[model samples]
Target: MFFHIVLERNMQLHPRHFGRNLRENLVSKLMKDVEGTCSGRHGFVVAITGIENVGKGLIRDGTGFVTFPVKYQCVVFRPFKGEILEAVVTMVNKMGFFAEAGPVQIFVSNHLIPDDMEFQSGDIPNYTTSDGSVKIQKDTEVRLKIIGTRVDATEIFCIGTIKDDFLGVINDPAAV
Candidate 1:
């Protein structure tokens, strides 16, 4: 029979692994931490759920690799339903305007705008109401709606509409 030593009973044990009891215990402990950290680290920096291990290419946009158990600092933004909130117009497309409402981002669709309006050729699409009146540009200081999302995750997505009382200006979003 081979000699064996456990040092003390206050230790967790694994089947006699490779060699030393101490070595086996250390490996076992390290393995536990690795597994736990890896599982907990798979998440988005923003609000979200149903996490999947992100691919290297998914976050290769200059953000270095995230080690397991991300150092997360939690902040919450609460928006009430049907409330009119002001935000800076960040992106404007034919479809709508993307704005930053407090901590959350929102989208405002053009259809929501009253009477389609006009901006530099491609700035705002030509919007003519069914009544044949030309739509005014709702493209400045855009007030938007807390519409919908781009994806269905725990992280909330927002949308806006110019048809409502929302307004936006033709400007860069990051400037705000």
Candidate 2:
């Protein structure tokens, strides 16, 4: 889920950015540094909303750069167990399929798919029901419930299932 959160960070201002537009420079730098930065605690930092406070700058001994304790509001995306997410299928194989929900990668094993669906092999691999009515393939949007999650320094991986009712393909590109 996406959330608007307040976060704090120490920002270093270079001597070149010490002029009249220091606030603008600081905000731009903050966006460059914090945006796309991922942490185990806060998930993925989406955007910097507003600056709440900027503490007094402390100068370093060797460098003229000033460090300011800045508190800012931002948005983040974090996934949790049992959360239902709509993801686009990226790859399909005999084992199962891989889908992406934003920065998170979700894996739905064959064991987790509905029993009525069977995996078919071809130039365009897919999983389809016996009657060929329901199908999951590349670019298909599926609603899945996350069964497990693991967050790393650079990536978030999730194990998902679509066996339950109302938790399967929401949009089938092939059907279009």
lDDT of each: 0.42, 0.91
Q: Mind giving the per-residue lDDT tens digits that candidate 2 earns over 1-176?
A: 89999999999998889989998899899999999988877888888889998888999889999998999999898888999988999999999999999877899999999999999999999999999998999998899999998888876788999999889988656755
Off by over 4 Å in 2: 171-176
**Candidate 2 least-lDDT 10 residues:** 167-176
Point out where model 1 deviates above 4 Å.
1-75, 122-140, 147-151, 165-176
Residue-wise C-alpha lDDT for candidate 1, range 43-127, written one tens digit per residue = 1222322222322222223544222222222223444445566676666556655667554567666666654453333555344
What shift in Å separates residue 44 of candidate 2 from its native position after superposition? 1.2
Which residue pairs collide in model 2, if any? none
Residue 70 accuracy (lDDT) in model 1: 20
- Global lDDT of model 1: 0.42
